[model samples]
Target chain A: MEEVLRIEDLHKSFADLAVLKGIDLAVNRGETIVILGASGSGKSTLLRCVNFMEIPSSGRIVMNGRAVGRAVDGKQTYSEKELTRLRARVGMVFQHFNLFPHMTARENVMEGPRTVLKLDPAECARRADTYLDKVGLAWKADAHPSELSGGQQQRIAIARALAMEPEVMLFDEATSALDPELVGEVLGTMKELADEGMTMLIVTHELGFAYTVADRVLFLSEGRILEQGTPAEVLTYPTQEGTKNFLRGHGSFRLPEPQLD
Target chain B: MEHVWDFSALLNNKQLLLIGLRNTLILAAVCLGLGLFFGMLVGAARYSKKPLLYWPSTVFVEVFRNTPVLVQIMWFFFAFPIISPFDIDAFSAATLGLTLNTTAFSSEIYRAGIRSIERGQWEAGKALGMSYGEQLRRVILPQAVQRMLPAFMNRAVELLKMTSLASVIAYPELMYQAKIISTIEFNPIEMYTSVALMFFAIVFPLALLVQRFELKHKAR
Candidate 1:
């Protein structure tokens, strides 16, 4: 499979503190990479950097062989136009759902196609319906984001991104804000996308889903990828001490065995 | 020992009052329409990141808002004709003053409405590949405009009241007509009372309608 995204020596700093340090990774077409880490581990920053939503302090992001932002005198640079074009190919689903409150679900889904793709209104409406149905939200087509439950809103958000037909999808803790019961529905929808071979880079702490669906699992610690491997190697048997500690904190990722007395 | 609250003279001059009422309404509507247009531009400028646009709009809003409206009216009516090469009648002066004053307040209201929106909405638009202009038009403004409507309506009512300030420039609006009628008829109480009632009749209903609209939006 062709490589869809590449990050080289990415670094991000705010004032005096560093958030991401010398990060390097590559995502292949149709590959699902789950970034698992504790809070402040810079997992979310890495996903944001790929789309140039948060510009990396040094190094570069190449999406489908094109540099995301410009390079001036060997220094990375960004413009509104450049970021916008990069964002078109990289769809993002936020943790908060972030649906446009004033628009209906169908309208929210149609917005990208109409505004970015400049699709005809009728075609936008048709595609919105198609994507809504794909997310099992056809019945709620006219419902506003405020009218939908958290899960439904997240599903519509996913469908909205899907309508863009992006080369890559980034999920930034997409289910973290959901009620426990609602988490499964969103996870199920995402699992379907993964099963269909959608290229995805996800920042999440849902270890169970990560174990089953992730093609590769990257455990980040203090702005660095501490450990990464297949689910069995990373989840079932973590090699690094930090990964082991994080898995132990989750408690469910350990082998099924006798309890301590 | 006895006093008669007679309104015959004012009543006899109903045509003058009607004309005044008509002129007042026309002035208010025209000024409001123009003010809202300029205010939208000023508000956009105030929110813009570029200092070139932001500073001039900021100074315009602050200067108009802090200075006296009557001073502004006289400056445009009296001093402006002297300072500039052009000329303007009392009616034009009144309209310019009222519209400029309304623009300052309306721009502030517009700024508040735009700022009240969550940043996440803008992020959502950007994440969907929208340009800044597209994001503002399709996403932010639609939501912001809903919030701005009630405030805009209230400002319209306030602008209607401020139209009376045009009387200082001898513009033939409601207050100017009332002042002339009172001076000629020597019934200041009845004439001014009538003027106050006319203002109440127009503005009270407007306030109630805006209040109702605001409540409905809050419920949503």
Candidate 2:
């Protein structure tokens, strides 16, 4: 399959400390990939760099057959306009679902299409209404973001990103801010999007969601990918001692996948 | 006791008083519009990051706010004619003084309103692909503008009351007309009382409207 996104030799260092070290990865279209990690493993940094929200110190990022951030002797650089357009292609959903306060839920979704995509108002409103309905927030079209709960807000954020019709979506712990009951609504919305063949890269601790919903899962430890395979292989039958030890400590006796008969 | 109480002269000179009322109303509206434009600039400048913008705006506000409105009138009307190298009339001078006086207070009201908005609002605006100017115009300023309105209007009413002071500059506005009539008829008590009634008629209703608007905003 053609690569929808590719990164080579990625490195991000803040001051003296390195957060991402010479990483290479490619994502195929219509794939649901989960990046699993302990806190501070640089998964969030990696996702942020993909969206160009953080500048990579050294890397080459190619999206949709275009070279985005290229390496100059293993140092990263991009033209200002190139980076702006690249970010518009890949939408990032924050952990807190940072929706605009002055706008209603529908207006929030319509903004990108009207401003960036330059769609007409009537068409944009129709698109926003469809996306909001998909996220089960049609009833909340006129409501301000503050009026919604965390999960509803996160769903609206998802719809807002989806309204842009970007090639891929990045979720940086989308459900982490929600209450336990609220988490289900957001996950269900994401599941629907995944089922509809929207390419997604999610950083999550939800092993059950990763095992059942994700096509493949990459496990990271201390800024490195520790293990990667189909969830059936990694979650059910992890080969590396580091992966096993990490899961054993955090997973307890509950195996997310069913055991062999 | 009876000297101040007679309301007969005011009834006889209703035409003069009505014309004065029209001029006062128009003058207040024009000065307020001009003042708020300068006031928004002053408020933005006061919060500007650069020292030059901040210092000049600060000095302007302090000079106008600390000095009496009467001094501002005399300076613009009498002193500025010689210092300015051009002779502007009494009405124009009064307008300039009133605008500068009201600008000082309006700027402070706006500054306080802008400061109260949540920091997260800016972050959200930026994330939604809005540039800094758009964020200020479409998001921050609208909220600030609504919050600043009651205080802005109250200060405007004060500027209107202070317009009576414009009589000292020889502007033919409401109080000036009343003074001209009093001097002609030799009825200081009756004329001054009529002037007070004219001032009260405009300011009291406006004060009540502003109070109601403020209460509605608070309830919301």
The candidates' interface RMSDs, in order, read 0.6, 3.0
lDDT of 2 by residue, A1-261 (tens): 878988777888889989888778888999999998878889999888887777888877788777775657756667656665666677778888878777899988997777667788899988998999999999999999989999999999998888888888999999998899999998898888889988899998888899888988998777778889999888889988878877887767774787789
Q: What DockQ does each candidate score versus the true complex, computed on alpha carbons? A: 0.85, 0.20
Per-prediction CA RMSD (Å): 2.7, 4.6
Which ten contiguous residues of candidate 1 chain A have the minimum total lDDT?
Answer: A252-261
lDDT of 1 by residue, A118-222 (tens): 989888888898899989999999999988999999999999999999999999999999999999999999999999999999989899899999999999999
Tell me the tens digit of each residue's lDDT in model 2 across B1-220: 4455666776787788778778787778888988888888999999999999999999999999999999998899988888887789988898988888888888898899998777656544444445567668766887777888899879878988888888897777789889888877778788887789878987999999899989998997
Q: Which residue ranges in model 1 land beyond 4 Å of their true spot?
A: A252-261
* Candidate number 1, chain A TM-score: 0.95
Report the Cα lDDT for residue B157, model 2.
85
Query: Model 2 chain A, poorest ten-residue lDDT window?
Result: A79-88
The lDDT, on a scale of 0 to 1, for candidate 1 is: 0.92
TM-score of each: 0.95, 0.79
